[model samples]
Target: MKLITKFVLLYLVVTIIVLGIGGFVSYHIIKGELDNELKWRFLDRVERVTYLLEQGKNFESPVQDNDDTNLKIVALPNRVEPNVEIRDTLVWHDRLQQMEHNLKLVAHRNVDGTSYRITTYGALVESDDITEAVIQILLWILGLQVIGAVGVGFIVSNRLFKPFRKTLERIKNFRLQDKNPITAEETSVAEFDDLNKFVEQMTSKAITDYKNLKEFAENASHELQTPLSIIKGKLELLTETDLSPEQYQLVEDSQRSVKKLSRLSESLALLTKIENHEFTGTEEVNLSELIKDSIQSFDEFITLNGLTVEADVEDDVFVHMHPVLADILWTNLFQNAIKHNVEEGNIDISLNSQRLRISNTGNPLSSTPEELFRRFKKDNVNSKSIGLGLAIIKRIADQYHYTISYTCEDGWHTVTINLQN
Candidate 1:
């Protein structure tokens, strides 16, 4: 069950149990009190009748004189006779006939010929009526109380959870590279307020760690690049020193290894920077113009590689994104196409509102499209390009909340970037 339902069910169960116990106790107590009062009234009437008989008064006259609505009188003749046993005669007068009473009577002859017996009973008029009224009143009150409790519960629960809902929404919408921390005001409930504080702390810590890591990687890559360049230059100069063929081959191999290392380090540094959200200068950029520029820049490379370039882009397609990052994205994609394409292959670039797609005819990737975005994932065997190119584009798209996808058909590979609103 949902949280609210569980809460409401538990609350109602407790309330009902308490109310049931209270109502049961109250009903019995009130009934007992009413019964006691009826018994006392009956006993008091018995005493009055006995007193009147002791005074040698006529029972009928006393019954007539006593106007008690719940009282009655009776007289019975002596049963014993001088010769043999004789039957007794009994007479009774219900003075208050209209008054409803549950009566109990006992008769016994006195020593004298005149005899009387007292009777006791309760007035039935008030007990049932009063009990019904009490029950009705209690039920009405309980109904109102239950309604109020549910209403109050809903209001209180919603208010208490309001901060949690807001915190969840903030986290969902949060951008790691945006560098904006959660700074909402505290909630009324202490637990929720504390939770919000904890989330803020976590986000802040994550952002700090990301920045530090990216900075370390970028600095290390820069430092390595300088030494690798120096080594490559020195190796070129060493070719003038008259080395053996074997030595020359060793030098060339070492130079190639250094060049590969340099390229790998550069790609790693770029990937880290992109993931860290270092590209921040953004404006409304014309994507159509960017695509045209990319094609122009890669024109000579395309021709030299015997690749046909096709651009089917709409004009003035604008989007809000970092211009430098966008340029890098297009450049890497275009380069990947040229590098991986077969001789005399075709490259098609298309753009429309909020979408840019690049497809190139090349060898089918060995890996699935889903794995293509992962670091160090290379599809072409002879390609010197590090696998971080697509990964960098993916990170850029993620930082900007854009959507990117890859598709492969026959020998053609397609990459699409969907710009976010």
Candidate 2:
């Protein structure tokens, strides 16, 4: 439901509960007051009737009298001779019939010769009418209050949510490539104002970091490219000059260094692109086929190094990932295994639903496990290694939400990639 509707409904429910309780309380209070007033008016009428009988002012039968304003009256004859008992008996019977209103009648006999009973009948008071009128007015007031409460709730809730709505609009229009940050100046609440400020800071920081990283990558690539090109050009020119065996060996080493530098630059560019989420569409790829292709490409290296290769991967264990990234990960891993293995060493490759484990007999890394995955971090023993192979694998694993771990035990270096399901 919309926020405003929810707020209005909540307000209505609370208001109704409060008004119902108030109405019940008012009704009971009015009823008690009306009953008390009737009791008092009845007592007053009884006093007046008893006073009239004591004065002996009645000239007609009390039952048939119409001059009494208190209540109806009925008279009966005495059962015995002239005595207080007989007079009390006549007054009791007369008062019983004279109780015309909704009230009870009782008799009291004094020791004197004069005796009388009083009629107790309720009276109709104006307060009862006023109480009914007030109840009706309260009902009308409650209805007006409910309407007012709903109106106010709608206005307040809408105002409170307005900033969030604008923030959503701004987010929808935001683009990562846009250098300028998206900010909101309109806010209806303090919490939203703070949120807007936080979002602006985060977006601005992201833009600044992206620009700096891109510039650094470009500048570093250009700086490295200049020397590599000069070395290649000089090597081509040295081909025409007569040189000793040692000079020829030096030229070959320079060419190899230039080639390695070119490859390193390409790898760095690929890592940057992957970090930027450049790969978009994805498809299911069979791991067994990918490993087979990688093995075929490195078959010559495996044979020349006299390495034993073992594969135990399933045929249908597939993953939904970017094909190019998957190829790069496996290629780097297989190449690293071949490059770091001992002569005639055994390389074991295994895959299952849980993970892919590659183990090879090679020189174990002396650094800690945490530092092994860091870019450009290699053991000082192997200066020829570029140190970016495992780092690229780490980047790919992160993109696919996978886990990569390295272990060295008993002269065997192992790399495990745990696939996320």
Candidate 3:
């Protein structure tokens, strides 16, 4: 729940509890006060009746005054009644034809050596009347309080949280590639200000770190290329000299080592560039055309390895990606297949809008398919792989936000890539 909503609800609960208690107490208090006032009036009637009897007035069936005070007086010939008695009882109303619950007050007095009993009745304050009135008033107050609290809480809280909402929007759009820090609007709230400062610091540091890493990627490839090329040239010249067969073999092995080292450096540099998001300009590239071209280029290698490739490529299926990365993606897939297949094994390639699946007949995996995506992980460590092909492909897929999975079952290795964005 929202903070404002919780606050409003809690306030309403407390207010209702307090109002209920106040109403309960007030209901009884008003009822008791009305009863007391009625009793006082009844006593006044007894006094008046006693005085009239002393003045030699004769007894009658009943007597009533202008205030509707019902009174009855009886002569107690040679006997005295109780000093005073009061109770609540039901009396019949002749005009309304209903039983009316009322207060009856009786008093005994002696006048001129004669005793008489005096009784009076007064209407009581009905508890139900008081209860209904109190409830109505409490409900009105509760309704007003609830309406006011919800309306004001939402309006005020919207303005108060505007800064937080803006900060979140800016953070979502922030990227290290932009090289710009997120600057939030100034606010009086301390917590929001703290958040703005922290995000700015974090993005600023990330951009600077990406820049340093990018510079290293460029330097690592260029600086190492010069020495490697010179050494390769020297080895090529040494091959022309009159060396023994064993010595020639040694030189050939050294040349191959140098070439492998060069390829490894280039592969690592490419991986770093992809990680840094260097290839970013994306266009609709026909992946179908790229796949067909890759298969044709590796025709010789496929034939030499005694492998058969089946291509079921659809025409003009486009993927949004950098053209250079597109080429690298399919090339790596074809290379991985040819490098790991058994003799006279079959390679199956399928492509359409929704997916691209490549299944090849190969040996079982040494590690789980997931572990193969990690850098420097390989099935055959000494198999001239350099152990970076699948890792590089995984990075390129991640760069384009593609889903790629590897699985091996019954001597068939499959790599399924979901082409949807």
Candidate 4:
């Protein structure tokens, strides 16, 4: 749940608890006051009736009273003891001719040598009226509380979270390599301001480190090229000189070693450039055409190995990528398939709307195809292969946010690259 929603729900729960307690206390207070008033009215009526009897009023005619209250006088054999008694009980009211639950108060007194008792009854308090009044009042208070709480909560939440939302947007759009990177935005909230300052410092440091590393790779690649060329030339000249068989073999081996070293250096430089995103210019390229051209370029190598090729490339499978990088990616994948395959093996290349797959029949691998993507990883120790081909393919695919996967079973290695439209 959102923070604002949780806050509102918490506020509502507290309000309900307080209102419940308030309602309980108020109902009892009002009921108590009403009970006391009813008792006092009963007692007052009894006193007035006794006074009228003492005044020697004649009792020849029937007396009438309000339906809710009654007064009666009775005579006894002797003077009655003077006392007051009250009880809640059922009494038959003569005027209404029905039984009623009332507060009955009786007073006994003597006047003119006659014993007489005066009784007064008041109707029971209406419980439903009291409940209805309390409910109405509580409901009004509850309704007002809900409206005010929601309004105030919305205003406070919006103000409180504004800085956080702005910070999130800045982070989302921040780019490390951009000339103008994101900076910490000033905020009234101290914690939010501190967070922004920390993020800005971290991103700046990371960009500075990346630039230093990229510059070093470029300088190192340039510095090594001339030395490697000189060494290869000297080794080639030595191979042509008159010498013993052992010396000639050593010179030939040295030449081959120099060539391998040069290729390894070039591969490392290319990998670094790809990582640094140096190939940023992009254009629309027909991927099917590119694949066919790559396969044709390798026709001599494929013929030398006696490999059978099966290509099922669809028409107009287009992609957006740097022209040079696109060619390098396809070249690496095709070379990897041919370089690792067995003599007289078969290569199957399939392409459609979703993905590209290159499956080649090769000697069963002791290790899985996943290890082929690591630098200097070679399945055959005797083969003069610089093992950075798969690694380069992976880097290029990653740059495009494409998915590349490898699966090998039964001497058939399948490399898949999911193409994006």
**TM-score winner:** 3
Stretches of model 2 off by over 4 angstroms after superposition: 1-185, 190-194, 201-205, 219-227
Per-candidate TM vs. native? 0.63, 0.57, 0.71, 0.69
Candidates' RMSD to native: 9.0, 11.3, 6.0, 6.8
Per-residue lDDT, model 2, residue 235, is 96
- TM-score-based ranking, best first? 3, 4, 1, 2
Using lDDT as the measure, name the better of candidate 2 and candidate 3. Answer: 3
lDDT for each candidate structure: 0.74, 0.74, 0.87, 0.82
Tens-place lDDT digits, model 2, residues 1-421: 9777786778777877887787778766765676566656555555666667667656333443233323543343433232111111112225345422233344343323544444433334333455567678777977897788777866675676777778878877775566788675747578888888888888888889988887798789878888889889989799669989999899888888888888899889888878876775689989889998788888888999999999998777798889999899998888888888899899999988789999999876678856868899887644778888899999989989998999889988889999864
Cand. 2 TM to true fold: 0.57
Q: Candidate 1: give the clashing pairs.
A: none
* Whole-model alpha-carbon lDDT for candidate 1: 0.74
Residue 16 in candidate 1 has what lDDT? Answer: 72
List of clashing residue pairs for candidate 2: 63-73, 63-74
Residue ranges of candidate 1 with Cα displaced over 4 Å: 1-215, 240-250, 380-383
Worst 10 residues of 1 by lDDT: 81-90
Best by lDDT: 3
Per-residue lDDT of candidate 4, residues 128-206 (tens digit)? 5677788899899989989988887788678977888777778787655574546888888899889989888888887
lDDT of 3 by residue, 1-421 (tens): 9777898989999999999999989887887788789988888777877788778877685777778778877777676855888888888878668786777888989888888888888676555567889999999999999999888887868887778878988888877778898865579899999988888888888888888988887898889999999999999999999999999999999999999899899999999888877788999999999998888989999999999999999999999999999898888888889988999999999999998999999988888999989988988787777878888889988887889999999999999889986
Q: CA shift at 91, candidate 3, in angstroms? A: 17
